[model samples]
Target: MCTVCGCGTSHDHDHGHDHAHGHSHGELHFGHGPAGAQVAGMSQARLIEIETDILSKNDRFAAANRQVLQARGAFAVNLVSSPGSGKTTLLCKTIEALGDQPLAVIEGDQQTANDAERIRATGAQAVQINTGKGCHLDAHMVGHAMEHLDIAPGSVLFIENVGNLVCPAGFDLGEDCKVAVLSVTEGEDKPLKYPDMFTVSKLALLNKTDLAPHCDVDLDLYEANLRRVNPGIEVLRLSARTGEGMREWIAWLRGNLGRKVPQAAE
Candidate 1:
């Protein structure tokens, strides 16, 4: 099974040769030596072709979802981070900062709806998608949930992707931008370790600055690593718990939403 996408099938194979080798059915067979050895090279090639097809299909769906969101004038933001990285807390702060503006949240988790409940407490419309054992939320799931939301045409929709750095980066949730959340407690080298997450993200939120005084996290090193992977990516240092640097975060969000909503027609 593939650990990244959680989409792989286990199969038993029989090798007619002295050396044990496994091959999937419908694969090419290369005749081995003068001993009539059965070649199973085609099976491996088939597997690669199937994997490519699956990813291409998924990419198509993601593009369609993006079009739908854009047509509705929705500013969708995908939040990604490790578990306990304070995604919900930052979302709550964002909701509060939006004030009377129309905002909706789509919370993704492995099991419980606890994060969605917390988001709803902030008076924003919140929907939770429990992915069960799945590590990431794909475009289809987000597109489906969008229909059930009460978001207005020009609303801001925040999709808090499952708390994971790897799989989520591989799956696009049809969002206008992906915002990666890395708490100070998670250390500064996270960007270096998870280069794909940082590279694809349009913005990086370095949360828990309030605890910086107590933790050994080096802010400079963290920012340096993120820049190394994506020099153009915006980085924000904030503490959701203490509300530090929240205004700037809110301002950034408002600016994005404002651009999408358009100015008053004279």
Candidate 2:
């Protein structure tokens, strides 16, 4: 039982054969302790302590990962959003458009290796992190991933976090910035409803603009809501499938990538 976060902990550390975060997840049972005695006996102070400890542990891991990347002068971006927000497609397009500049990806999901496979298809080395029953990717998991991947100096590492809005918002994975991908098809009120995500995000990608005309999506209302939640958040109207607004995304990536800029030819 994890006194911190109450999410429990696994110290098996099975990293020999599997991918990053080789955790032996424990089965979750409802009600705290035997016959729910612990839940009834637990004080509010204990719960607060747990939360603080959990976050602090995660932050320690995040800090170490940040130091490593900064030392190498590499850029790390965490891409987060709800499921089916075209994040994978956007990454594929970004990788292809960037054109071979030492790019690697860490794909996080609960199940299959499909997303990582899709990313590798675009001509970049990629690895998948399967977080079974886990809604968010924490810093510890990402740190493990960095050990296996070749994220060298002046390279770009994109960590595609698990599809989640609430949990991922609070967890810091040692990223330089969080890029929120919100699809127009998801609805205009998402930003207002999930304000925490927008607040944490440095940039919001208004994806699927190609389908905006077909759907009754209000771009203005979305803009207002997003700005209300994150006053200074940069936004780009884009469509990953159609090759629209991709140049701007590349420019953003280049500006954030290390000291030496990537050559136009490669």
Candidate 3:
């Protein structure tokens, strides 16, 4: 079990070959301990220790990934959101807008290559990772994906993490920043309800705003709550389908990417 988020650690990678990664994924049985009695069998201190160890190891891997990207002058952003937030649509639109910009994508999901295929349809290089029971993608998994993903020098890389609001917030997958994609339909209190995700995000994209009028949601309240958690987070309200506010989103991407890969942004 992944003590960081209590999610399953087993993975069903998209790659064909088998290689060993130094992950501390041990088989954790919840019931039927000593004397045929059901028990959790672990103390709070032990749990904390395990969590620390896991995060520490993950940080090491993240640092290595960061170094490689830096050496290649590649800018990476980790886009995270809950399911059905229109993230894929926004990503596809962004790819379309960029046109000839050197870009690659790392798509993460628990099953199927559907999203990766969508990205490929846009003519951008993409690698899909299927994490069978894993709730989030760790640095180790991303580092492996990078091996197969031909990230170009002075290009932008987008890592679309597993559609999870909680687990993905804690794991740093060597991205330059984390962008939280929240649909206006998801409710205004989402930032308050999931503060960790908002707090960790550098930017929050309020997507599908074209439906805000239909949903009777308060856009101001959403922004207010997002600021209550992450005062420094930049928010962009956009509709991927209608092309509304996409220019600003594209500008933000260029500005951020320029910090690392100036030619790609240009």
User: Which has the greatest lDDT?
Assistant: 3
Kindly give the number of clashing pairs for every candidate. Answer: 3, 0, 0
lDDT of 2 by residue, 127-239 (tens): 89999877888899999999989986788989999998877887888888999999999999999888989999999999999999999999988888999999999999999
> Which clashing pairs does model 2 show?
none
1-266: candidate 1 lDDT, tens digit per residue: 12221254343344433334447885543333332232243244344444465567667878987877677777889999999999998888888878898878999998998988998888788889998877788887887888889877788999999988877876767788899999898887889878888899999999999999999878999899999999999999999889888999999998998787663111
- Residue 206 error, candidate 3, Å: 0.1
Candidate 1: residue 2 lDDT (0-100): 24
lDDT of 3 by residue, 156-181 (tens): 89999999998788788898999999
Question: lDDT of each model, Cα atoms only?
Answer: 0.79, 0.82, 0.84
RMSD of each: 8.1, 9.9, 9.7
Q: After superposition, how far is residue 219 of candidate 1 from its true place, in Å?
A: 0.5
Model 1 misplaced stretches (Cα beyond 4 Å): 1-50, 263-266
RMSD of 2: 9.9
